[model samples]
Target: MSLQYVQGASLFTHINEVPKQYAYLTQNISTDVIIIGGGVTGSILGYYFSRQNIDCVLLEKSRIAFGSTSITTTLLQYELDSSLRDLEQYTPLENSLKAYKLGLKALDEIDAFINEQGNNCDYEKKDTLLYTSKKEEIAEVEEEYNLRKTHGFSAEFLTASSNPFSFDLKAGLYAMDGGAQLDPYKYTHQLLDVSSQKGLQVFENTEVVKVNYLDHGVEVETTYGYKVKGKIIIVATGYNTQLFTKRNFGVKTTTFNIATKPVTSFGGWPGRVLIRDNSSTYHYFRTTADNRILAGGEDISFVPGIFNEDAALEKYELLEARIKTMFPLIKDIEAEYKYCGAFASTQDNLGFLGKDPKNDKLWYCLGYGANGILFAILGGMMLSKLYLGTFDENLKLFKLDRFDG
Candidate 1:
């Protein structure tokens, strides 16, 4: 079954022009590695593999970064969807700490990649605020704060009085340089552009329909009747993984977002920090380089064929109302763009990264969380090392069989 990706106008696509397109696969090709998706994750994989002197071929059914990547809010945070205190219940504390630390490293990796390419994708470093609206949840927020402090992270606990924003913050944790934001659509193209110059072959409008596992390698058949032979195959498809496995790896949801026109003042939003509440289904807001406010997070359980015009309008209205309620000072704020798309979250809220246990030559790097971009960075680095015969202990936490009890 197919899934609906994006349903409305995305602000990122409106601001950025489509990058150069690649030809579809029309003949049999061979490579060391074949990436199945050409969104941000696949582009990242192509970048990492090509840099390591691997012959990499990336295939996309549609234009690059035109799917869920275009609709992404591009909030890069080290924090996962599940809090550190909560995640420790599923795995060891050390593993949870490693996941958190990996996030920081991923942020640095992205920064380095952007600098190395000299591509301006509106990348910027910013602090993050995880706050709670209800006074009763103050203790839980403090517990999360203490966990971070114990791990040697630079975090501060703030109350309603110390909070910089005008909104009600019963308690909050301010993480220093713990998050960042960028233009995902542009970043994907920039990375592919750099990798293409280094012998990476990217094919757009090329959909892999079937895979035949050979004794020495694998052959992937495209819908266009072409074949791609690779020693290893990497599935970087975001929420679409039914083609690779029958296991239910995670749950899918529809997330809504709204972007406002550029405002002249920051008002009480100090330093324009990335803000997310402590609610179960939290709302997150951040500022764009062009001074527009982007607020997202009215997530609901996924239902087939649920992304229609009526659904988009309803979600957009709710998102617009949320922005007005949180920051009433921004008078005459009009939503210039509104969009919604599918996102996935794992059982433990950690990404699935590593080779399929049943198929060693087949690797999966499905990053299912709010910090998906960060996870993608880690997946690219670790997977590259894995192919070079270097195994990381942390991969145990993200292995495909981790959920098989």
Candidate 2:
């Protein structure tokens, strides 16, 4: 089983009001696909595969949506954690542009899901702002804005004298309709619930103790000693995968978040736009469905933060202070929920997807950065098609062995 990503009761769980439950694996099962992890990524995979009439089983070690999904800020932005100029040093500019476009595609895919399945996840499209409070960084932000605008992307460059936001901003790139916000915990359950109705067997508290990769298929033994046979196994177990592969995937960091009580007044924050300061610390903020301001991003290196209380509390205080300083117009900024969890990120600010380079029977849908949700959406659409004799060339962008030296 994976280690807990979150420590206390998260805001997402309390907002759920009535929680959904799944049955434990009481008997052995056989299916075409066995998804390991019932978080948002695995739930999305199940939703895609189940719709294809593929017999799939989703296994969660503990309660569904209570893992890393519950602790996420759920600020879905198409932009990566790094700027395109910085990302170009690792990959070509065209490739970075393709990633940007893929993010938009993923956003549209989520929109379709909400349109068809009905929006019970409090999903909303929001404009994303990545700005700089320092005068020295104005050129860097402007360059990024110019690149997007040159590539025909819908972006507007905001200056200190111009934007509508009351926060400190010398320069900012406003990505119009390229970002979103949602209740990730609710979204995971909703996807799994919908997928379960279409032959997707879901089991909670059913941990996989061992995985045996056979010549044609894979078999996993659960903690209850029940075996599940499947043609393929997809690993979406957040950041805990010591048993899956030997190669380290990404660098782990403990990120903090604080959610304030709902504010009835709009204040100077017009339209509740999503905002992120592109400083060294990479802080971000968004408005929740209930009008509460949710902000995060004092990132420190480590897989878990619960081991150190003093450090975590320090981060929470910093975030609380930072939010109040930035949006002084917003009233009653008391923190109703404060938490931190593990966040995995690559140097290129991208995630790993597609089949294992060494093992064809195993696949990875691990979205390891700020754009995890978008990457997983693309993974579900591409990987699902791959199982049905179709291959998406875009999968080449997120191959598992891209960083191998």
Candidate of highest TM-score:
2
Q: How does each model score on TM-score? A: 0.97, 0.97
Candidate 1 local lDDT, residue 324: 82
- As a TM-score, model 2 comes out at 0.97
Ten contiguous residues with the weakest lDDT in model 2 = 1-10
Q: Rate the local accuracy (lDDT) of all candidates.
A: 0.87, 0.88
RMSD of 1: 1.5
lDDT score of model 2?
0.88
Clashing pairs in 1: none
Residue-level lDDT tens digits of model 2 in 1-405: 154667655799887764678889999889999999988999999999998999999999988877888888888888888999999888888888999999999999999999999998999999888899899999999999999999989999999889787777899888899788899988998898899899999999999999999988999999989999999999999787877987778888888888888977657787788888888769999888788988899888874434687888888888889878877887778888888788888878889889998889999999989999899999999999999989999998899888889
